[model samples]
Target: MSELIQTYWPMIVAALVLGVAVAWFVFSTSRKTRVTGTSRDVLDEGAAPAERNKALIDSAPAATPMQPAGGAAATPDATGDDLTRIKGLGPKLAATLRDMGVTGFAQIAAWDDAEIDRIDARLGRFQGRIRRDDWVGQAKLLAQGEDAGFAQRYGKLS
Candidate 1:
């Protein structure tokens, strides 16, 4: 029994040491790689590299005017005012309104609070801001073709 114990003791010790070494290595590696930045860090430091890269890509001049895959001109209505010119209307919301046959501010101006709420729901977190921003008043001014009142009313569009 003593002989057996002596033989296994060294093995047991080695195994324990190996486990501790492995655990330490894993823990240290994870700590080193973990993101340490807080939300304030991001806000204070400006946009991250990935976001800057994306903005650069989006703003890069096109090599050639993009044509439709099937060779169509891809011309949207040239006359109607772009609803996306409004303060809170993003590309997605503009596309949504366009899909709903809402090409201009007139369509939006016609929408009641309930309808606006429904539209705002599609925009996720922007709903409250959009509602409070007096989108209807801005839309009404745009629909009426009055420019002078807009700046005083909506501040800036973009």
Candidate 2:
């Protein structure tokens, strides 16, 4: 065992150095951005308003729902279809939409130009995709359960 260790000592040292380098790279890159709050502070559901507000402002921005003229927040329907069924919406985009309180094809189908603009602004990198993809038109068909029509127009909903 001593002879084998001596034989491969240089290689073993190289491997240890390589492993340390890779570990350092991974850990350095994987460090989460240093926000103003701790994970516990952010995760506390019943935190006081001051802490909650601090956490909210320090966290990454997410989609914010556009309220109607009545000032009541629009919520997604409980029986809404899986939004990922829409051609352009992958799981990530669907989750983002859900986070924004968008559920149900009918809600999307009913969006006017102004509402679409407002919501598009909140979509970050996905802005203008709604109009580009004709989501409203596709949504109208989907809401009506017109799979055949939707498929004909937008291809398969994969």
Candidate 3:
């Protein structure tokens, strides 16, 4: 029995060590793969760099012509108005209007139906909002720089 134990002791130790190493390797590799796989799943699958860049570019406002160059009226400087003072206009629409070169109450108040349609068409998701919210009337009142009527009618200043 002692001889048998001595003969097989080293082999037993080596077998135990090999088994532990294989188990450790399998578990570690599976754990790493699971972590990476879950992280990949959490990331946006459709969000390619080119598509994301294109969406950003598309969302960016284009440079709009404010007034005719060298025409009858002198072009207004690029300084913009706070179009948000109009009751219905939030900051986003105000920024969009400013991007479209609509910087003053005079410009908005002066819009005829055709001009309104043209501008409204440019308003993207805000189409028909001008007519619905009476933006022209609001502009007319705001252009005068007196808010008495506007406040009475619109309930509050923006």
Q: Which scores better on lDDT, 2 or 3?
A: 2
lDDT (10s digit) by residue, model 3, range 1-158: 99998999999899999999999999988867333344432247764556666788879575555552222322335775678888778999988777666778877877778778877887898898999999999988888776889899886786
Clashing pairs in 1: none
| All-Cα superposition RMSD per candidate | 13.9, 13.0, 11.6
Ranking by TM-score: 2, 3, 1
Model 1 agreement with the true structure over 1-158: per-residue lDDT tens digits: 99898989989899999999999999988877566765554445675656876788889674442222222212335565677778777788777666544566766667676666766675666667567767777888877777778877777556
RMSD of 3: 11.6
Residue pairs clashing in model 2 are none
Candidate 3 has an lDDT of 0.77
TM values, all candidates: 0.47, 0.54, 0.54
Candidate 3 segments exceeding 4 Å error: 1-62, 66-78
Root-mean-square deviation of candidate 1? 13.9
Better of 1 and 2 by TM-score: 2
What lDDT would each prediction earn against the true structure?
Answer: 0.68, 0.78, 0.77
Worst 10 residues of 3 by lDDT: 68-77
| Runs of candidate 2 exceeding 4 Å displacement | 1-76
Per-residue lDDT of model 2, residues 97-130, tens digit only: 7776677787788788777887788788888789
